[model samples]
Target: MTGHRLRHAVRRADLPAVAETRRLLRDHLRLWGVPAMVDTAELLTSELVTNALQHTTGGAVLVATLSPGPGPRLRVEVQDSVARRPRARVVALPEDHQGTSGRGLFLVETLADAWGVTAWDSGKVVWFELSDPRK
Candidate 1:
């Protein structure tokens, strides 16, 4: 698939919209015979979108871009109007059932081949790219 792109914009109140975005990516990846990554992609998208919804105010724009080159990659961008850059807090790993926090970015880091943040004049976008299993 050359020049493939998928974009979605939804308010925080629209939770189903988020799930639909994930499903769209899952379907596209399935068509590309990368079904193995569907679940991970969906989960990652969910987390990113959820973070944006919880942290921002205006809305969230979830963009799924398929980049074809030497190797294919699925890129997801979640834009938010929040002023702060999405930062990952390093937390101590424990085996007990103590309260924990700030693991969303950690989960993204664990699953994404590459992940980072891009700051815009108005806000920022937290993005993650997963290698296309087909490639």
Candidate 2:
């Protein structure tokens, strides 16, 4: 694996895993001069993992890498055991939304520089790329 690529799996019980992943992502982006999308990074990870926990029965693996991508796009891939492909829609934000949950894939679709899904062994990989937020 290239030094620019990093990946980790998070058990459903490991909330801290999400945060740490976000930090690593932010650091990577910062080093790349990709701009301060920490807020975006944080929210994006939250949504991806939340969906995995709620919709899938097993844990999720979050993979982040600054690999061969369209210019200025930072790639992110989240793999989960659920075979369902994600749908993107604009829905009214629920009034009772308590925590920063739901609407994970939607954000990925909207905010990423590019986003898509791919087939996995028993599931699928949800991926998104964000344009260089710095410039």
Best by lDDT: 1
Q: Which candidate ranks first by TM-score, i.e. highest? A: 1
After the best TM-score superposition of candidate 1, give how far the Cα of residue 48 lies from its true spot, in angstroms.
Answer: 0.3
- Write down the RMSD of all candidates, one decimal each: 2.5, 3.9
The lDDT of each candidate is 0.78, 0.68
Tens digit of per-residue lDDT, candidate 2, span 51-77: 676677677888877654344555678
Name the regions of candidate 2 deviating beyond 4 angstroms: 1-3, 68-70, 82-101
Ten consecutive residues with minimal summed lDDT in candidate 1?
85-94
User: Which pairs clash in the backbone of model 1?
Assistant: none
Each candidate's number of clashing pairs is 0, 2
| Candidate 1 residue spans exceeding 4 A from truth | 88-101
Model 1 C-alpha lDDT per residue in residues 1-135, reported as the tens digit of each score: 475777888786576677777878888877765677788889989888877877776678988887777577888898888556645543545566355556677788888999988888778898999986656
The TM-score measured for candidate 2 stands at: 0.71
